[model samples]
Target: MSATENGWQPAPDLPPPSSSVGIIGWIRQNLFSSPLNIFLTVVGLYIIYKAGVPILDWVFWSADFSGEDQSACTSGGACWVFVGQRLSFFIYGFYPESEYWRINVLFVLLAVLIIPQMIPAFPHKKWLGWFFLVGFPIVSYVLLLGGSFSLPHVETEKWGGLMLTLVISFVGIVFALPLGTLLALGRRSDMPVIRAICVGFIELWRGVPLISVLFMASVMLPLFLSEGAHFNKLLRALIGIVMFQSAYMAEVVRGGLQAIPKGQYEAAAALGLGYWRSMGLVILPQALKLVIPGIVNTFIALFKDTTLVLIIGLLDILASVQAAITDPAWSAVAAEGYVFTAVAFWIFCFGMSRYSQGLERRLDTGHKKR
Candidate 1:
């Protein structure tokens, strides 16, 4: 039969590859497909030009870089000179000028510990927990706080800015997670007394405002302790944050534990595994895996919530930015200070969410056909 005869159709003509792909096609589809898109393209270009060109010119071409004072930044751009001059205080606060290397080393160690947990080929899961949760914290505390072992002492009061934010969030997570897990397990347990106590603790914390908790930690906590007992202000705040975060973490983990099927537990029991063994081996591994997204989300929230340290008179990164802006030298740059903080927070939170997505994809093999 002819190509166009006997119900046979001729091959449809194809567009040239260059026209069908790459920049021209992308522009046609995204920027000018409809009247609204065309309008948006024009509006977006105008906005970018208005905002971007001045910013780039001011920050790079017009702004000063090498001066110790805001006097060098005579133009209308970002006074990055202020940042450059005060970079040390921004990072280390009142930390001893000479001992800042301790903080840097501790940060490096944390990065080393965290990097392995992120990789798929790291050591066995149990060993990883032992190293991260048990070993690394001890080492990090000794290196950073430096009260014993002849390392120079840096008081927690001297901690400020981003370093303080990291310390608060890290300590909060480390202390809260195991406590949360135990609460979740107890909430699900058959022991009535334990279940009641766990429920009360979780509910009590969840019911109050975190700010109020911080206030109590700052003001009321000292009254509860012995008269002579001393607690660092930062330590008190960390305790409050952990207690508050643990309640939320408990709920997240509880959801995962409840979503688990009963048969999995029964099967573990049939295998003669005891309570902790069955939960640890057969149940929690699956449950925690299922809830990793939720756990990471809670963690991200806690990281942002560290900004609440401002109410307790601590200079976490957000408060530090506030302090930087209020300085008469940089008062005009409040917007920029906030924008910078938002950008830093966005980068960290966005990276965590992306990592969580990657983990979800990696662990999605259960539903695939063998």
Candidate 2:
């Protein structure tokens, strides 16, 4: 049927250009938009292929998983048997085998308390969060240290591996954030004495390396305590981590506080809000939102830095891995131990990073233009 001959010619429709739709279009626009980009993309893919393939091969394709010991790993692949055999030690350190149930109980309790707070549909999240932050530590202390209710007292020296790592990081994070916020506020106070005290504390702590601070806490801190006071190694390290990290956290928070516009303060004051109310109800929420990335970054660094506790005789997860590799039977499997340690750390840190990103997206508002 020839439309032209019918005197009612129909206009033809054509498909959109293949270069402007679908995955191919995305690749064209994002990866090959220019000649330089095309070159870089090609190079990047080549690099990934060269590095990733062998890593995957070593990790899974040729790796030993089901073996009970290193002898079972003879395929020239990663000897994951070493990690498997010592997995409990890596998790709970020298804590008594019979008490493994205690650690599991703590893990279950943590998830029960935390998951509800994360779910948006859950009610009274605020109260739960407060309880988790304040009460859970006490509960954990009783369970882990086991001094109360006739439970055998597990000394501080008995704690190590991932349990110790999590303890230090969690307590440091819980205490540091609030303390740091207060320090930031004090630093910005109108009273010169209060401001000077905060400035001194922040500068003093920030000036020293965390390594030195840890060393001091381990060796020298005991001299100043009252006579007969029993200060445990883990306790000292916890105190050091909090104070040291608080200094850095204060700065991160202060940067956020400064970014806030002056008009917000005036608005808070106009509503008859006092200083604490103004800061807590209005200023802090905005300031904290703006610096979510920095706060999370500090936390990530602190989590990794817990590895340094090995210096003061604390066998954190990395230290536990190091200990595992020292065994004569598993000496050749050091790489596997390290890879396991790395994967464990990466999982936790990546979770925190992603969660912080989601929080930032949820809180970030009003500043973007339409």
Instruction: Give residue 146's error in model 1 in angstroms.
Output: 1.9
The residue-by-residue lDDT of candidate 2 on 196-259, one tens digit each, is 9999999999999899999999988899898999788898999999999999999999998888
* Predicted candidate 1 versus true structure: per-residue lDDT over 224-327, tens digit per residue: 99989989888889889999999999999898888788889899999999999998999888888888888888999999999998988998888888888788
- What TM-score does each of the candidates earn? 0.87, 0.89
In candidate 2, how many Å is residue 341 off? 1.0
In candidate 2, which residue ranges exceed 4 Å CA deviation?
1-11, 17-38, 259-274, 277-282, 285-293, 367-370
Error of 2 at 330 (Å): 1.0
lDDT of each: 0.84, 0.89
lDDT for model 2, please.
0.89
Instruction: List candidate 1 segments past 4 Å from native.
Output: 1-22, 49-61, 122-129, 328-331, 367-370
